[model samples]
Every structure is written in C-alpha cells, then in structure tokens.
Target: MLYFDESGYTGPDLINSKQPYFSLASIRMTDEEIAQIKEEVGYCEWGRELHFKSMYKSYHGQKILDKIFNHPLMDNYHVLPSFAHKRYCIYANIVNILVETMYHFNGINLYEGAKNLILANGLHCFAILHSNKDLVAEFENNFVGMVRKPSIESVANFYRTTDKLRYDVDTREGFFDMLSEIPPTIQYIKEALTHKKFYIDLTIPLFSVSIQEWYNKTKVKENVLFDSSEPFFANIEFMESLRDMEVPETVVGYGKGKHVYPLPVGNMEIAKSHEEFGIQLADVFASALCFALTPRNDKFVKYQDKIKSLPIFQNIKLNIAPSTNDFIEARMKETAEIDPLDFLCEHSDRININKKSNI
Candidate 1:
C-alpha cells in the first residue's frame, strides 16, 4: 500500500511570520508490514500505556541515537543539525530521520520510485492516499488502474484520539494536535493478500536528493519582472486554467475566497492583497523543498541563500516577480469593498489597478 502525505503546515500563515518550516511526507507500506513495524516499535504491545513522550525516553534514548548514527544508512545522510540553526535544525533533523526510516522500511521515496516498482510488477488497482486533492488528481491522470480515496478524516481522527502513549516524546505534539483536527488520506495496494509477491525499491530518495543537488549547483540567469505577491495567492487565471483542464477535483476543503488550501489559485483570506499570499507560498515552497532535499533544517534566510545557488531553485525564483506597490494598494482597496467569495467569483479577470496610473 502507498500512503502519501505532506507535512509541516498547520494553517495559512499569511500575516504571521513566526512559523518557519513546512514539508511533505509520503509512506508506502503493506498491512503486514505496518503491523510488523508497529510490533517492532512495541506500539502494539505497549498499547496506550506508553506515550510518545515516555516512549522516546524509554526506547530511543542516547543509546538508540548512537546506534542510528553508526548505522550504514547514515553514510550519506548526516544526523547532526538537520539544517543550519541549532534549535530548528534539531527538530527538523529528527522528523527527517523518522520519515527516512519509514521510507527505508517500506522502500519508497519522494520521487515515486515505489510506484514504479508496483507498476513494473503488473500491479493493478493501486490505492493512492494524499491530503492534497490536486496531487491526487495528478496521479489519477497519470496512472491507469489507480484508485484515490480521501483519508484525512481517518488519519486526523487517529492522531486526535490515539493515546500519546503510542508515540515518542520528540514527536511534535503540535503536529499530532493539528493532524487530529484536519482530514488526511491513506492509499494502499489492492488484492495484496492474493498476490503476495512484490519488490521493494529504494532509489527514489537518492534520486530526489541528487536532482536537488544538481539543481542547486547549476546556474542560469534571465530577465524577469518582479511580481512578488502573485505567487502567494491563487491567480484567477491559473484557477481557471485548472478548471478548464477539467481539474476541479483539486479543489478540496473550504478555501478562503478563491484561494484553495493545498494548491495555489486562491486569494489570501487574511492578507490585504493577493500578492501577499504569493510571497508566502513562495517562501513556504522554497523552505519546504530545500528542507526535503538538504535533510538539514536551516533558517529561511540561509536556506534562501543555499537555494539561490541551486539551478532549479534559481529557475523557480527567477519566475517569481515582486508585486509592485501600485498592485498592492489596488488589491487592498478591492479587498476592503467586497466580500471574499463575491470578489473571487465576480472579479475573475480583474487585476487591481491604481488610480495614480502608475505601472
């Protein structure tokens, strides 16, 4: 079974500047494998008696860290400060390692190598679970004999009600708290009981890491206008494009104005202008993707510098232009006069224009 998800987000941080990290995590495992992992972790045996907090102290102490650090898998991946800063890096590194461990056990990575394995084996009716509806649609469009199911409710409920005893202390309590509140999706391989033969593939993460490294190392330049704020909010034209493409399934959960939760194409609910949302999204994506590739938690500024050095990151940034002050002011005015929904629905093609006639 393939369970895919992205993490490190709680709510849209349009106005707030405190939270620093956002990420995505995907896990692929069979029912039996999940059970076996749970057993190995003593989660099944301990039941609710052991909470994540206590479990971390009891099971994954300094001794466990030593073992993991010395393990062969640690050769390429470093455990020290996952990122640049000391505090944030530590937390980020721990989460990265945990996700890495899960992927190692299941032989899957971010680049969809596991799915390739399933496809190569003539596997059909593969279940794909993800929180992002757009991602689900993308997968469905690309793959034949694939089934998509929304599991946000199930995953959220599990995190909410499950006794903390089942998890480790170092686990972000806020993550569990948020998961308990939001809906999550889960995917799996169908008819695995009948066809037990399967091969586990483990090259995707390396591929992603390598690609990221390559991107970071490469350099290119282009002439581009600055539209800083557009990347944060969902552009009306972009949303229309997706809809015209017959991709409305990507719109899941209640969005603010025309802006959706998981995808770009909606407005920033709290911000005075759509441009702000674009900036925020750009920052979030840059931070998350960098964290994913680097496996080290660095501050946003430092990460930005590192990303600037990468070819792919440079390409992405080059595409992002800063919003002009005139655009910002006009958006603020528009937002003040209209209800978000009405504005989103009615002003589809309208870009805010300043009365001053400044470009």
Candidate 2:
C-alpha cells in the first residue's frame, strides 16, 4: 500500500513567522490487507464513515461542539468571534482526534517513534521537496536498509504523469485556484511538480469539511490534547514521533489548492482510465494525510488562533462559505467596481448587485 498527502500552513504573517511549514499525509491499504495487519496489531473497526457528518455522529451527538463555541475562554480572545471560527476550531480538533485514535489503535505512534517500527517491518518512505532534504536524509540515515528517493521540487505533478490514465476522480480546479492565491514562497510548490522525475504511482484526494460540520464535531471534549491553534502543528508532532520507523516505499503528496484533503480509513475504489494511467484509492488517501500533517511554527499557531477568534472570520462564513472560488469571485467583483472618481469621497460605497456568483 502507498500513502500520500499534502498540508497547508495558513495563518496571519505574524503566526507563520514562528512555524512555517504546513503539510498533509495519506495512507493506502486494502480491507483484507488492513484487516490482516490490524489482527496482527490487535485492532478493530471503530467506525464506518470518514466524512465529518458520519464521524461526528458516531463519536459525539449532534451540536456536541457547542461547548467550545460557548466557552468563556473563547470570549476573552478576539480571534475567533464568529461561528466560523468555532467551526474551524472544531474541524481541527476532530482531525486531531481521528489521527490520535488511529495511532492508539495501531499500537504505534507515528510521532513517538514509528519510523523505527516501520523499518523493522520493512517499509520504504520518501518525501518529495527540495526544502525537506535535511529532515528526509536524517531519517534515511537512521533507518538502515530503507530506500529514500529525492526529487528536486516542492510539489509533485501527478496530474501530468497520470493524464493518460482514466479514473473517476474529483476535479482539481478548486484546488488549483486556491494554490494561486498563496504567496510566492508557497507558489513554488506547484511549479516544483511541473518537472516529471518526481512523479509517483499514486493519487490523492483533498477536500475541506464545511464550517457547520467542523463546528458540530469539534464542540465535544475528549481526554485528548487540544492545541488551540492550527491542527497541522499537532500532526507534525505526531509524524515526528515516528521519525525512527523504517517502512518500505513511502510517498507523500501535497494538494495545491483550497481543498482540505480527504482522510481514508475504510472502503474505497481504485481504478484506471487507461492501462498507462490510473490511480488507486489507497494512493490518494495516503497523499492527502501526509499533506495535512506537515508542520509550521509557533507563530503560525498563534496566528491561527487569532484568526479563529476574529468576528470577521465568522461573518465571512455566513456571507459566503469559505472557498477559493468564492473568495476569487468576490475579489474580482470588487476590483471591477473600483472607481477613481469615488476614491476621494469620505463615504463612497460601491456595490455591484448584478454580478454572477460562482461559489
């Protein structure tokens, strides 16, 4: 099985200064294969669905996350003032729970030192990014007999490689559009994948949970560590715990857009459009997970919390569900309506009521 994923380090510039790396991680395994592996590890089925709607209900009751929103601590902080902030907070927390649950069930902590275990069991892990060479190489050196492949780019262009293959995969336009809005430092991620040598035999699906869903699942309290910030930092912490694991053939994929990459745990399909190009469900799941777990700094952690506390963040959610296309359309509309003559007016408000909305 192949695991791939992507991650995003999104927050105000202030927070990003501390922790700058954002990533995702995904893993792939067949039901039969995972069952055999789980049996060996003394694990069992905990749930059925991976979607937030199903997972939330299975883990906690509806509106269970209201507690987080109603917390007095939330009111003290101005960062997460609206329901949207509450929603984002909940989504991050739910992901943390799922990852932690998986770790405990597997009798392995990807963060605590799973790499050594993986290597002992014969697994290969490879990361594609020019920037992570030092970290990747460090792991390669520690885990003997483990193969590490290096690609000289931040992003891997699986689209170009799999263009010939046919599969029933979701469109990537939303993802790509999200990537375009990021700063130059992040923009290179897409450019890096344009080169072909980095291609791998995998596909990854990245999707974000809706704000309402995020809020519903996150409100519940669990006897788990809560980071009170972007969950990626915690995810990286978990991955770091497995730095010593040796596993055969590990692949990581990053989503270059707005989609919150999907998490895969149960039944899914793997198919090909043509023999030359096709993808398996496992490949996509792995990639998405890897990306989500990428790390950033303390600055990002603080900024994320602050963003979550802001009233504007909440209004943004109600005004328009947060999305790449919605943001772009809104910006384009504003740009088109700007008037030089009105710039000097003290209270000039421009409104284009007839523009097409494409969110």
Candidate 3:
C-alpha cells in the first residue's frame, strides 16, 4: 500500500512566493514496516501528531529524521516524489495563454475590471485579476501576436532547454523577474478563489504523473491513503478520478512505459487521524524533502546545514537533482514535465478546467 502527503502547497495561487513549490510524496510500505516506524518514533503524552516542521527545530526532531533515514527497513520502502516549481510553473503557461486569448475578446475591460467584466461577459468567474490598466495593455500589445493558447498537444513545449533565464542566488531583480512571468489573469483568480475547484484542478496532474511512474517501475498496485484534510483536492471524487489517468504521449518524460501505465489504484480515503503511523511517516518525509531543496541563506541556512548530516541527505529515494541548471534538470527524476496548459487543454478523461465552465 502507499501512504502519501504533500508540502509547500499554497492552493491555486501557484505564484505564492512563501511556498516555492507544490510537492507530493509517497512511501510504499507493508503493515510490519508501519508498526516498526511507529514504535521508533513514539508519540507524545499529549498525543500530538509528530510533524516534521515543528519537530525539526528541536533535538527530538533531529532524532526522528535520523531514525527514519537510518532505519534498517529503509531498503524496504520505495519513495515517490513529485513537485512543481512555483516561480514559472505549468499554470504560468495556461495563464499566459488565457491572458493572450482575453485580448481577442476586448481585454482592456477584462484586465482593468476583470472581476466585474468576467461576471458581465457571461464567462466563468474562476478568479479575479488586479493589475494597472496601462501595464496590462502594454503586456497584451507586446506579446499577443507571439502568443496563442498553445495546441492541446504541444502546450508543454516551452523555452525549457534553450531559452532559459539566469538569476543570482538571492537578488531583488531575480525575484521581480519571476513575478513578472506570471499572467495577470492567474493573479486575479488566485486572489479571489471563490471557486475552490480550481485548486483541485491544478494539483491532481502533478500527483498523477509521479504515481504513474512509481507504478510502472515497481508494478505495485497502490491502495492510497491521504492525510485527513478538507482541501479541495482531497475529496472522494478527485481521489477516485486518479485511478484512471493517462499522461499525454507527447509529454517529456512519459516516453513509452515510463509514466504512461495502468494506475491500478485500490481503496483510497482521507485517513481519519494522524495516529495512523503511515500518515505521520509520510508527513515527516514530505516536510524533510522540501526543507532540503528550499533555497537557503541567512534565514534557512541553519536548517540546510543540519539536513546535510542526516541519513537521508542526498538519498536516491529523494529524487532531486544536485544541480538544476535547466528546466528538465529541475523536474523530479521520474515525472514528466509539468505543462498545466497541456493538462488543462487535453480535455479527455479529465475534469474540465476550461475557462468557460471553470468561471
């Protein structure tokens, strides 16, 4: 069976800087391994769930990381990691196309008074956009000709390999460039999340692509259990839909038998409580994975330094490349390139997230 959890998620607002990436991770383990992990990481007297974030600060937390990483049973667990770089994620592509498309339908009103116009124009009010009119007009006029809602088949084909941007480790210019890449339409919808379904729509494919590879390689029929939460993506219908999904054939990493395989998903549910040891273990693994990859400086360097000494430091199961100089380098080892537009535009065997019905 598989126990899954996520970290660094900030809903549909993929551009949120506080969360650099939306990541999902899973550990495949048997009942015996679960009991062993529980006994190793004992519960507190208050019966609080052993979360990695709060614990990583204390000695006990370091000990927990050590135990999980060094446990003799480590060889028995197979890890699945999937994530999206928030700075220029797949949603950035979709929002870019959507903004360009709005221009054809009189984008001035949509950009300036997007919320009101979206409501008045009889389009889906998925989210609201807030930008200065002059700036939006400049953006539209500059790129409208070069931009079109990419064909459903080739949406993931962006400037990944050749045309890439460079940035200093920590600089104001770098930060601003990342923000400028996001389309105004995405900003509006993310801020006014009146419809929670958009968040669900954006995240499922990230998980699906990763889980598909895990199944393809290991041939494990997964019976998934998610940590108990009321987030839009954790709903019963969404989890069930994961059972039948096919990554596009043209997708980057899903060449043949890679991420394009049968999902043979079994029973799936939100775990009633974190007392379930598998969920807690997954929580720890997910949090630790994020902490290791997150940028480090004055504020987070200490955590990064400490993480280097852990048994899981550079563990093959973690799947992050040592250096991510290019777009393909940034992706998880086994997952396909994240093309949110392609996922949204495919419109086959997926919950439709088209702007018309989405609003």
Candidate 4:
C-alpha cells in the first residue's frame, strides 16, 4: 500500500516570498510491513497520530525521524517525491522573457531596468513593469539599434545577481549558475493555478505511475492511504477520475513506450490523523522533504542546518518537468546547456534564493 502527505502547499500564491514550494511524497509498503510500523510506533509510546509538523520540534519527533530514515525495510520501499519551486519558475520563464525583450532594444538593456527595480522591491517589480506600458514605449522611442538580439548571458546574469546587474558586466560565469538552479523549478505551471486540489490533483498520476511500475516488478497491487487533511473533493474526484478517465497524456510525464497501467484509487482510503502508522510516517517523510525544498520562513530559519542534515533528507529523488508554456520552454531551451536533474540535485541542500542567507 501507499501512504502519502503534502507539504509547502500555498495555493496560487505559490510564489509567495516565504513559502514557495509544493511537494507531494508517497511511501509504499506491504500489509505486513505496515503492521510492523504500528508495532514500532507503539514501542515509541506514540499511541495516537504522529503529526510530523507537531512532533518535529519535540524530542520524540527527532527520534522518529531517525528511526524511519535508518529503517532497513523503509530503505527498500519506493519513496516518490514530486515538487516545484516558484521563484525558479519566475526566473526560467517570467524573467527570461523580460530580459530577452530588454536586451536588444537599442542596447538599452531592460535587464538593467529589471535588476534595479527587483533589487529595490523584489519580484513585485514585475507587476510594476507590467503596469507601466509607458516604460516600454519610452525605450522603444529611444531605440537606435537593432531588435531581437540573442543574449543568453545577459538573461542568465539578470536572474543570477539582481544587485550586480547594475554595476557588473555580463560574464559567462552566471550562465552556469542559472542553469544549475532551473531543474527543480521547471514543472508545468498549470498545476499550481488552483488552490483547492493543489497537492492531490497534480501529484496523483506521478505517484500512481511509479507505483504501477513497481507493481509490474513485484506483482503486488498497492492501495493508497492519504492523510485526511486533503480536500474532500480531491479524495473523491481523484479516485473517480482514475477509474473513469484515461490519465491525461500531458506534461505530467506519462511518457510513451512505458507500460501505462490504469491505476484506479478504488483501494484508496483517507484517514483524519496519523493514527494510521503508514499515514504518520508519510507525514514525517513529506514534511522533511518540504522543509528541505521550501524557502526559509521565519519559523524554520533557525533550524536550517539541522533540517538539511536530517538523515531522511540525504537521498531525495525529484522529478520536475519543463513548463508547458511554449514561450518559457523556448527560452529555457536556449538559455541553459546542463541537465535539469543535475541542476536540482546541486541546489537541493538549500534554498536557491540569492538574497537570502545560504542554509
């Protein structure tokens, strides 16, 4: 069976300054192993639900985290984690477009304009620029040079250092930095447009696809148990959709030639708390992942180093697809040479925000 939980979900305000990650994690186990987990939790005196966020700061939480992270059985189970960072989304598409627009207009780099504005006011600068059509008009009027110049370095540098963009010349060094940051950030943005079903709707197929593949190898049909915090519609609709419809062949990575199984959630169950040992452990695992990926909020800033070093965090697997938006994908393809998975792994240990302190 599969037990799962969600973390860092903030609806459509996904790019919010403090919390900018949305992750869904699932842990697959057999019925026999789940019984063992219940026995383990009972030994720890965790008679009721073991909420990861609640237990996280307590002595009990750390002990549990250590237990699950090192468990030989758990190490064997498949842990599927799918997540995305919003700021990187902004950088890969939103900022890239603006940089390309500003770079070639009579040599009056709009990237300089974007940098100066963003440094002073953060990403909200985009709203100001978007609102001010007059700025674009003024630049166009003064243009004395050619348009449509392809300057990938200028765009990468704008994303790399907002402050330095004003004083420093564009260099090849920032190109590597920008490519290193895009992989974990490159999923389809459409998945984030809604708040009600943010976690389940977006991640169900991803989890199911992986689970099906595992079943093919082991000949075990895994059922799913989700923490009850998920919206009722998500629980009901996801199960119904999986049974009634074909998993949409979209950017969600139902890649061709791979054995596609109809993963109905007929066996899916939802519980209100960590009362179920499987759900509880899923909570712990999901929360740990969310903490590692999300931007630092006030509550977590103090524990940054400790959180990163947690054993559960050591070997995380992330799958993020490029934005489905054509414009963004075109720019992303032209701007970076490195692979997305490598880039995300390199930056996985800490938040990728430049203005923030490194964790």
Candidate 5:
C-alpha cells in the first residue's frame, strides 16, 4: 500500500503566484514497514502527528527530517513524487484545450505517436521565447475564465491572443495547422461550454497525471491513501471513476505511460495524516520538494541538501515554467530520447522547431 499526500494545492488556480508548484508524494509500505520507519525516525517521541512544516523549522526537527529522508528504507528506488509547476500546467492546458480540441474536431489522434507531448512542449518553448508576459497572461486568464464560466468574451479574447501568438513566431516547426482551426475549436468550446463534463478544473488533469504514475509503478490494484487535511474535494469523485472505468485498445493503448490495465486504479481513500505514518512521510516529501524547487525560499537550499540524491524510480516533476532556455531544451531532448524513431517520423513537421533561433 502507498500513502499519498500533497503540498501546494490551490484548487484549480494553478497560476497563483503565492504557490507556483504542487507536489504529490507517495511511499509504499505495509503496516509493519510503516511501524519500522516510525521507530527508525523516533516519530512516536513527538507525541503527536508528524507535520512537515513544524518539524522542518527547529534544529531537532531538521535532524529528524534528515533521518527520515535518508532512512535505509527510503532508498533511491522507493521515493516517488509528482511535482507540477502551476504556470506550466496552464501552458499545457492552453495547448490541450485549444490544440487538442482542434485535433478532435478534425478526427485526428493527438495522443497517437505521442504527438500531444511534442506539440505542448513545442508551443511552450516557442511562446516563452517569443511572447511577452502580457500576451501570455491574457491567454491564460481567458482560459481560466472560459473554464470557470465559459463566457463568449473569454473565448473571443483567447482566440485573439492565440491568433497573434501563432503568427508571432514562424509556424514551420510548430503545428500551425492546429492554430488554423482555432475558429471551429472556439465554436466547439462555445457549444460545449454548458456541459460541466467538458470544463475540468486544472487540478484534475495534473492529478490524473500523478494517478497514472502511481498505477504505472505498482501495476496492480493497491490501497492508496490521501491526507484528508488538504481537501482535494474535486479529486475524490474523479479518482473513484478511474478505478471503475475501462477503455478499448483503440481509445487507450497499454505501455509505459499508457494505461496497462483497462482503467488503471485500485482502492483510494482519505485519512487523517496524524493517524497515518506513511501519509506523514508523504507530506514531508511533498512540502520539501515544493519548497526546494522555489528559488527565492531560503529553505530551498537547505531542503535540497536534505532531500537530494534520494532514489526516486517513479516520478513526475513538471518544471515547464520559464527558468532558462536550457530547461526547455533538455525536456524536449528527453521526449526525443524516449522514442527516437517515433519522434523523428511523427514529428517530421516539427524538425525545424528542434533548432534554436532568436524568435
């Protein structure tokens, strides 16, 4: 069983400046294993539930965290986490909402041959390089508005900003075809706006990514627990549906990142963190990793020192926010490395995008 907990959850407001990243961590252990870990870290001495922030504050607390993060059981292969940069979540959403809608309208399989990843990363790298914050902010705000209420104004604004962005950069490398169909896609969004099923909160998609990661690692139905302290009220129903659902191979193929089981999931529940030692450790990992990724935080350095180099075999760290060009380049390179032939053949249209330019 794996106990899951998260840090930096601001509902669907992914662009909230106060918390730019969300981290979800899970540790797999049996009851006996949890007891062993608690004993190893002297968790019972606290006489209360182990909370990460309070424990991370004091010198003694830091020592305890050091012991917990470095415990023999929490080895490199055991640490599993899913980290999402909120802004990047929106970036990917912009592509998925607009471009994926376009593809669906045209009866094309965006997910086939991993084209979704290629286009999302391609659009993101190009937008950050060529588009200014105001332009991007307009696009992002319109997206949030459209999802929340689906206003005609929001769609119009989004369409205008998207239209400008598409032409701003040369489209030879990127999928301009997706952009060309924006009008029809906007019409689709307008019609579907009233359907609650169509407008998923930002948290749902990123949370889905994490759930898939968990199932991918375990590949079996297992008990997954979440810290009830942070209310992901939106996640509960979606999670329940995942366990009960199944799909045909044509709809979703089985593979490393794809769903192996029809609808990969097991039993998932919510529990108080204080009552669950495994959940508490997940809290530690989520908070520490979230803080460590934020450059301005002083604990960023100290926290990274304590948590770095841990064995993390299954993870999702979506750091697509604009930090450096190298960050974008490195991730794109990883996509290519995953399936060089598929990437080469499928992304032939994007060959020029692989090159760097002033635009």
Candidate 6:
C-alpha cells in the first residue's frame, strides 16, 4: 500500500501569495519498514502527534528528518515527491480547460503528444512576459471563480478577461488564439473538454503524476491512501479513472518526457495522519520540501541546499514553469503549425464566435 499527503496547498485559489508552491509526497512502506523509519529518525514522543510543523521547529526534529531521509529505507523508490508552482498551475489549467477548448474548435490535436503541456507552458511563459500583474491576478481570480462554480456569468467573466490581453508572443504565435474560439456557453466548453476523461482538479495532476512515477518504477498497481483533509480529497473518483484509463501498449516520449498510462495505480481511501504512520511521514516529507522551496520567511530559511538536495530529492519530479520555448523552437515551421495558434493569424474567417456550436 502507498500513503499520500500534501502541504502548502491553498486549495483552488492558486493566486494566494501566501504559498506559491504545493507539494504532494508519497511513500510505500510496510508496518515493519515504517517502524524502522521511526527508529532511525528519532521519532518524537512529547508532541500530541508527529508531523512536520512541530518536528521542524526543534533541533531534534530537524535531526530526525535527516535520519529519515538518509535511512536505507528511502534509498530505493519507496519515497517519491512532486510539487507544482501554484501560479503557473492556474495558467496551465486555463490552457488545459479554456485554451484547449479553443484549440479543439480549430481542429487541432490538443493531446497528440506533449502539446498540452507545451501549450500550458506557452501560456505560463506568455503571462510572465506580458508583465501585467494586475491583469494576471484578475484572470486567475476569474478562472478560480469558474472552476469552483461553472456558470454563464463565470464563463463570460473568464472570456472577457482573456479579451483584455493586448499583445501576443511571436515565438508562440497564436498562443492566445483560444480567445477567438472560446465558447459563449459553459456547456459547450464542458462538453468539448480535451482531457476530461481523467481530468480532476488542477491541483490533482501532481498527485496523478506521482502515481505514474511510482508505477514506472515498480510496475505495480497498488492501493493508495491519502490524508482525507487534503484539498483534492474530493477528486477520488477522478483518481480512480486515471488508474483505469485505456492506455495502449505504445509508449510515448522519452525519459522524464516519457508518457506511460493506465497508471498501474488505483483505489483510494482517506485517513487521519494520526491513524497512519506512513501518511505522517509523508506529511514531514511534503512539509519539509515545501518549506525549503518556499519558506514562510527569512526566519525559517536554513539548510535549504541540504533539504533540497537530499539524495531522494534528486529523483523528485517537479512541475514548475513551462519548457515552452524549446517546444516552439523545435517545430521549425515558418508559420504556426498548430491550429488556433494560427487560427486568426492565417486562417481567420469572419465567422461569428457566438454562432459556433458542437463545443
């Protein structure tokens, strides 16, 4: 069985400046193995419970983390960590749900390869370059509103927000072209969702990604458990679908870029960390990693390199800013090869957006 936990999650409101990064840590360990971690890490006895916050505040607890991380138990693939930049995640979600819808309308292959990721990163990088913090915030806020409660007004607000963008990226030409194809009705967009087959909350992708990482390493479809209190607790069904996705024998991409499917992972239940030692450990791993990446302030910043460079950290996967530039450069096309990006640029027609149907 595998245990899961999360830290630094600000729920669906990713625009929160409080914590820009969110981490989900996973560990596969038997009761005996868990006991070994406790023994090696000098597990605390005085605290009401063993978790990251209390453990990290004291010297003894910090020392315990070191022991736990370096213990032979973690030497293999037993412990896996993954995180996402909250700010970029919102933009990527916009691309995934909104912009991807736009691409679908223009007859583009939205999920043919790594295009979804590349497109998401495309928006991520463009937002950074646009240099309009207020605008970005407004857009994020609207997206959050839409995801929480989808409606015509929310959809209209989101679409109107995109209309506010005044410029475009030359390298990722037509990246913003989704604006042109954005459906006026929320139903249309929902019906035409690009990856809704297994789509969960924007926050859950890292969770799903972590499962794939474990599956790739162990080739096992195992039962998983999560701290019920986590933000993505509501997406249990979606998690199951990811595990049951109909992936073909053909694999795609290479190395970390590689894509494996049907995830070889399924079944989920929620439990309080107090009842599960592995989840408690996951808490420490997630909290420690998140604090290092985004410390509360200068007062908490120490041993960042040691914390970030732990032997296990080397194998940890990250979901941060986009690798979009390389994708666009590799295309080597004089014109935008993907539709929607090149939609209005070269294939523009005077068709009215509101009149479009079939999502």
Model 3 regions lying over 4 Å from their true place: 42-47, 90-92, 95-202, 231-236, 242-258, 296-300, 308-359
Query: What does candidate 5 score in Cα RMSD to the true structure?
Result: 10.0
lDDT of 1 by residue, 152-203 (tens): 4433333333333114343344433422321221222222111211111111
lDDT of 1 at 280: 23
In lDDT terms, which candidate is top?
A: 6
lDDT of each: 0.27, 0.25, 0.49, 0.47, 0.62, 0.65
Relative to the unseen true structure, what is the C-alpha lDDT of residue 349 in candidate 2, on a scale of 0 to 100?
A: 20
Count residue pairs with overlapping backbones in model 1. 42
How close is every model to the real structure, measured as TM-score? Answer: 0.22, 0.19, 0.57, 0.52, 0.76, 0.76
Q: What does candidate 2's lDDT look like per residue over 1-359, in tens digits?
A: 22222223243111132322322222223346444443442222322222222322322411222222333322322111111121122212212222333433446433232221222122111122213444433322321111112243212222222221111133144322322222232223333233322121111102122212222334321111111224323343322222212222222221111111112122222223121011111222222222222343543354335334533234323211123444444433332122221221111121112122412
Q: What are the RMSD figures for all models against the true structure?
A: 24.6, 25.2, 12.2, 14.9, 10.0, 8.3
Task: Report the C-alpha lDDT of model 5 over 114-187, residue by residue, as the tens digit.
Answer: 56665566655655554366766666676766766666677777778777756655443354554554556775
Which order, best to worst by lDDT?
6, 5, 3, 4, 1, 2
Which 10 consecutive residues of model 3 have the lowest summed lDDT? 119-128
Question: Lowest lDDT 10-mer window, candidate 5?
Answer: 335-344
After superposing candidate 2 on the true structure, give the runs of residues whose Cα lies further than 4 Å from its correct spot: 1-68, 71-162, 165-326, 329-359
Q: Once superposed on the true structure, which residue ranges of model 6 sit more than 4 Å away at CA?
A: 44-48, 167-200, 241-262, 318-320, 324-359
Please report, as a residue range, the 10-residue window in candidate 2 with the lowest summed lDDT: 198-207
Candidate 2 is scored at a TM of 0.19
Each model's total of backbone clashes? 42, 78, 5, 0, 2, 0
State in Å the error of residue 262, model 1.
16
Instruction: Point out the higher-scoring one by TM-score: 2 or 6.
Output: 6
lDDT of 3 by residue, 1-359 (tens): 77777788665454455666656667788898777666765544325776788887777666666666677765433555555555333334334344434442443422222222222221111111312333322333222212322232222233221012112232234333433333344334323233334332334665566566666667666787887654423555654544445443333232232334233566776775465767776777667767776776756577667665555435333232122233222222233354333443353334444334657
